[model samples]
Target: MTAKFASLSCAAIIVAATHAFHPSALPSSSRRPATTTTTTTRLPMSFMADSSDYKADKSDFGDGADEDPDAAPAPLRGEVDMADVPVTEEIPVPMSRNNVGNRFLAVVLDGSFNKDDAKDAWEMHGDRIALTERHVMWARKQNLYNETFNLESRADVLWSHQLLSSDLQRAVGHAMCIDSPTIEDCREAISRDPIVRSLLGVDPETGMCDVSPVPLYRWRQIRDHTLRIDDGRDGLPNMVMAFDRPEAISDGLREEVSNDHLEYLIRSERVIAAGPLHVATPDKTDPRSIAIGTLLFFNAVDREDAIEFVENDPAARAGLYETMTVHRFNSLDVTGKFVSENLYFPGQNTYQMKEAMEHWGYPVDDLQTKWLNW
Candidate 1:
């Protein structure tokens, strides 16, 4: 329900907690000039939550967007007043693979802002959450009719109705979803054929090569609610579906199918944002293995809807993936409205950043070969 007041509900103006930035880590103002980083402070890119009511006039803080980065503090208004917000932090990239404690299952994002280009992420909590709620409902219904597909298949068509936040909608690109039941049948076929196993890398024991579950550094509200990452330039991408190619299928066939497959997805309106994984340089291998791909869906009203979409990808049809998973793209914690772009790393050029996203399986997956040209 929309927050309403007799005129404007107090609920509409609910206060968020203030986030503390290590002075050294505060994002540099975009309007200023700075070529090198000169500080090292540790503060989670997210903010702290506060519920105390605010009584300040709008003129006091200027809605937090235009707050002076150098201002000592505004003259106290009355009771409680919100503080200033700085640029968004760098992406919270998880720590590298290791074996420290529960490190195997834990993910830690690189949370620092020492670059001039780096800024905070935008906040549209009210809008994004509405998208999530509608999705949960869509998933429940599709899961009922989707028993026939592989557990990991993204059932996109289940709920034809889609709800998306404006930011989320803009970031979606071509996507292919796949997971299928024939995989079991393929398992039987491979067991009887050695050529198939080696070509497809099918384990005789398990037919699917297995989509390794890539644990991620997920973020949420300082109060523990999840958030979607929107580079602020592009829309906020809130969902991701990850799938890997099994050795069962040849790379040659998979690539051939993807040309048609991606086109089909876009025409079908199945994907909002989607793309395939590629190497820094084109792979010369005949049948290349697709490390992974991500899809920010448009019609994923439910889990089964998401599964249906994945199950239908042409690559999946060609036996490309071993496993797959779909879930919220939890990228950062939030308290108040963020004023700057928070989804990037400082000092990293867009070219380098695009390549680095492959580390998280998000290389501007459009499959355009020319974009990689130096």
Candidate 2:
């Protein structure tokens, strides 16, 4: 069953439909910088909408509406095959949940960790993985787990946040978003996890790990859009980017820039997930509650390709974001169709969790028993 589930998960395809954003009603600004690259040029019609909507915009096809016979075909409209699928009012598209409330992106870095040096740390590492999975299971029960993933290239651990260390020789960590009412509650959650505390490397006697939660007020993902998780982009590395907005940028300018940004992302078709990062639940009527930045998870040919993609965005060019960092990341399909269809079992008290841990080669005796108790 484990092997079969693994095989199926690897072959899963995720598809997301493009969202249409009509021109913003707010005032506009030409803050978007000019680009020399043809790929970055704005198209005649916004890619954020379906290609069928722009059939009249013949400019998209060269000067061959009725004159030239050699012009190439118009762009293919993105569509999903739902022939055999049942139709219902609530079709249960995965990852469409509007998980709201106070959430923090937590990062856990292990400085002494090296994937190659796993001999001595293997037992401890397994314990950590087992414990973290247990934590995720608990979070799932409490409706707190949003997403959990580790750095694909570096650490074996997982959590989400960015921390800079100058003297660090090597570091591996994971990141995740946890729903907690307050920062103190977030810290307590981290503290209760023994493995996380050890990973923080705080001195046992007097030292303490102080977690300053990076509050994510709101997260917006296109509901109907599905992405093929197994799209043949094996050569490309997945990327995780966090764009930080400078306070100086006003809501009007950011909204104007988003029009171009969204179009570029849709046209690129590399986006796995892309959305605005709000500091708090935003009121449509309140300009002050507007999103502060953007979070993009996508695929790129390489590091350079990822950098270029973000750099070419209208928001980046307009200096809307104060800092935008892109890093190569490996994504786990947690909270997505991959999890629900493969590893997860509805209700509880199943051996699903045990099977998952065993498949990952983690010692599951205690962890599995603990999970069953919940």
C-alpha TM-score for every candidate: 0.26, 0.45
Q: Please give the lDDT score at residue 363 for candidate 2.
A: 35
How do the residues 1-374 of candidate 1 rate in per-residue lDDT, one tens digit apiece? 11111221111121111211111111112112212435665433433357554444344335677777588764443323223334544434222121111100011111111123232222223323334433333333223221222223222211111222222322111111111122232223223222212222445686654211112111111111112222222222224333334342345655567676666565654344444432111221323322233333334434444445556766566655544433323322111111222222322335565564344232244332223212
Q: Which stretches of candidate 2 lie over 4 Å from their true place?
A: 1-104, 107-171, 179-196, 199-209, 213-218, 222-237, 240-247, 280-289, 332-374
- Number of the top-ranking candidate, with lDDT as the measure: 2
lDDT of 2 at 56: 35
lDDT of 2 by residue, 187-276 (tens): 555554444655445656876654432122344444437433333253343434344444534456677777787787777777766677
Cα distance off (Å), candidate 1, residue 84: 26
The C-alpha lDDT values of all candidates are 0.30, 0.43
Top TM-score: which candidate number?
A: 2
